[model samples]
Target chain A: MKLLRNLVLAAVAVGGISAAYAAGAASFPHNLVSGIDAAGWDLSVRKADYDDDEHEGYRRFGGGHERHHEDDDDDQGRNYGQNGPGPAGSTTPPDNGLILKGTAPKVQVN
Target chain B: MKSFLAVLAVTTALSAVTPAIAGEVTLTTNLRNYGGPGAYLAYYVTDASGKYLGSLWMSGGKARYYEHLTGWYRATGGNLGEIAGITGASVGSGRTLEVTLDLADALFDAGYELHIDAAVEDYRDSPNEIVVPLTSDGSGQPVQGSRYIADFTYTR
Candidate 1:
C-alpha cells in the first residue's frame, strides 16, 4: 500500500508540472502582446476600408497617435490641440527617437 | 520515461530561445518630394488571407489627420492605442521616417504582409501605399511606394 501511495504522488507531481508547462506555452502570444502594451503601444480592432464588411483584428498605434477633430472642441482641453507638442499640424521636423514597430509573429501549430 | 524527459528538455530549450528569436526590425520610409507638407503615414500588417492584423507605426501625431490613413483608421476606429509606443514625427517631402523594434520570429514565411498607407493635408489619401510580404527572403529588400512614399525597406 505504501508503494502504491508513492506512485500516485509521483504521478500527481508529474501531472502538475506538465500542466504548468502547457499553460506557459499557451501564453506566449499573450506575453508578447503584454510586452507591446508595456512599451506604450495601443492595440485595437477596427474595420478595413477596402473590405467594408470585414473587421480587422488588433492594430498597434503609437502613444501620441491621437487625432483631434473639428467637432472635438469640448474635448480639446483634455486632449492635445491641433498644434501642441505632438500636434497634427506642427511643422517641426520628425524627431529621431526610436519608435518600436512590427507585430508579434503569428504562431502556428502544424 | 526517456520520452518524457526529452519532451521536457525540448520544451525548456524552446521557451528559453523563443523570445530571443525576436530580432529588431527597422522600417525606413522615405517620402517622395511630393511638394506637400508632412505626410501622415500609417504602417500596419495583414495575415495570409489579406486580413488586417495590427498597426506597427503611425507617422503623424494628430488624430484628425488619422482619417487620411483610411484603411488603418477604418480598421482601428481611429484608435490611438494602436501606435502607442510606435508613434513618431511625420515625414516631410523628400525626408525619411524610420521605425525600429523587435519583431517576433513566427511572422515570417507564414503569408503575413506589411502595408503602408499615406496621406497629405490637402492631397488625396493613399491607402495601400506599399505592401510587402514578411519573409526571411524579403528582408532588406526595398520596395517603391505608390503615392507618398518614395521607398520602403525592412531589415534585421
Candidate 2:
C-alpha cells in the first residue's frame, strides 16, 4: 500500500511539472481570430422567428443570402395598442442593473 | 329563488348608479438570463380570499404557447378573449416588461392578489411565478419570481 501511495504521489508531481511546461497555449476563444462573438447579441438576426424546422423556406437562386428578403412579416408584437382598450403606453422601466436578454411578443387578446 | 332575484335586482341597480372606481395600475417584470426564447407570461388577479378575479395581461401572441403556462391555462381555459387588448409581446431573457392599465380601485388593499404564470419554450412551466398581495403597501416593492421572472413590481 505504501509503495502504491508513493507511485501516485510521483505521478501527480510529474503531471504538475508537465502542465507548467505547457504554459501559454495560445488563448483560443478569447482571441478574435477564432470566430465571431458567440454571444450573438449584435448579430443582425431575423426580426420574426420562423418555424424553419423542415428547411422549406428556401429563397430564390439569386441573392439568396441577404437577410432583408427573408421575411416581410413585421414584428406584429409591437402593434398591441391598435387592437384593444386604447393605447397603453409604456412607462420608464426601472434600472434593475441586470443584463437584458430575451423578449417575447404579447399574447393577442383578439 | 326569490332571494336570488331580489339580490340580482339590487346589485344591478347599485352597479348602474356607482361605476367601478379604477386607476392606472402598472406591472413591471424583470427576467433572468436563462438563455432561451422569449417567455410567455399570464398575469391575473385574485380576490383577497384567493378567488380568481380576472386576467390582466398576457405576453405572447401565440396560443400554442399558452398551454405551457399550465396554471393560467387551467384557470382561464386558455381563453383568448380574457386577455384581449391587455396582451403584449413576450419578454426576452434578462430583460424587463412594463405593463400599465386602468385597474379597479377595489383591487388595492382589498384582499386581492396579483398572480403571474409563465412558460418558456423548451423550459420548465412556471405556474404562479409571482403571487403578490394587492395591498397599497405592496406597490413599488419588488417580489422575486419562481422561474423565468427574476423580479416583479407594481405601481399606481
Candidate 3:
C-alpha cells in the first residue's frame, strides 16, 4: 500500500510540473504571440472595438464616424487602363501561344 | 512505289505539325444607353454541362470591379491571368464592341455555350446577360440581353 501511494505521488508531481511548465511557456511573449496567431486573431477585432468606442464618442459629438472604411477603400475609383482614341482600346491581344488560323485576335469599339 | 513512299513521308511530316482547325469568329456586343458609367463585360465559354472552358475577352481593365461580374468571378475567382492580354477598356453606353478571334472549330456545332456578364459602376450587375449556344447555324443570330446589352451576335 505504501509503494502504491509513492507511485501515485510521483505521477501527481510529474503532472504538476508539466502544468507549471505550460503556464510559464504561455506567459512568454513569443509563445503568446504565436498562440494569438494560431487562434486566427486579426486586427479587425481590435478595430471593431475601437470603432465602437469612436462611434459612441461620435454620438455624443456632432461628428459622424465612417464605419465602412473597407468599403470606402474599394470605391476609390482607380482606373488601370487608358481610354485612347484608337480603333480599339490601348491594350492589344497578347501572344498567349494560342494557335490561330490567320491574324491575331483584334478588338474594335465603335 | 518510290513516289508513293515520298508522298507518304511528306504527308506524315505535314500532319505531325498541323494545328487544330481554327476559324475567325467575330463577336459583336451593342450596349443600351443606360446613362451610367462605362460597362465592363466578360465573355467566357462553357461546356454543355456549364463547366467553364476559358475566357475569350474581358472588356474592362480594372480588376477591382471584376467582382461585379458575378458569373465570371464565380467561374474564375477573378484570376487576372485568365484575361491578362485580352483585356480592354470598358465600353461606353450605346457603344458597339466587336472582337474577332480565331477559335477552334471544335467549339462550334458542339454542346458549348458563350456567356457574357455585364456590370456598370454604381449600377446593377448582370450575370449571364446573354447566353447563346455556339453553333454554326447560330451564327449571325442576334441574341437579346437582360440588363445592359441591347443585342449580341456571333458571326463566323
User: Considering every candidate listed, which one attains the maximal TM-score?
Assistant: 3
Ranking by DockQ: 3, 2, 1
Task: Output per-candidate TM-scores for chain A, rounded to 2 decimals.
Answer: 0.23, 0.22, 0.23
Error of 1 at B152 (Å): 0.5
Model 2, runs deviating above 4 Å: A1-110, B1-20
lDDT (10s digit) by residue, model 3, range A1-110: 99999999999999987897788853446778788889988634433353445444221101223223232222122345442111123344433333252345687889
RMSD of each: 30.5, 20.3, 17.9
lDDT of 1 at B134: 89
Model 1 per-residue lDDT tens digits across residues B4-84? 999999999999876655567878777788876677778888887777777766676666667768888788888665555
Q: Compute DockQ for each candidate against the true complex.
A: 0.02, 0.03, 0.10
Worst 10 residues of 3 chain B by lDDT: B79-88
Q: Candidate 3, residue B60: CA error in Å?
A: 1.0
Best by DockQ: 3
What C-alpha lDDT values do all the predictions have? 0.66, 0.65, 0.74
Residue-wise C-alpha lDDT for candidate 3, range B10-75, written one tens digit per residue: 999998999658878999999999877678898998999998888788886656667778899999
Best to worst by TM-score, what's the order? 3, 1, 2
Report the candidate with higher DockQ, 1 versus 3: 3
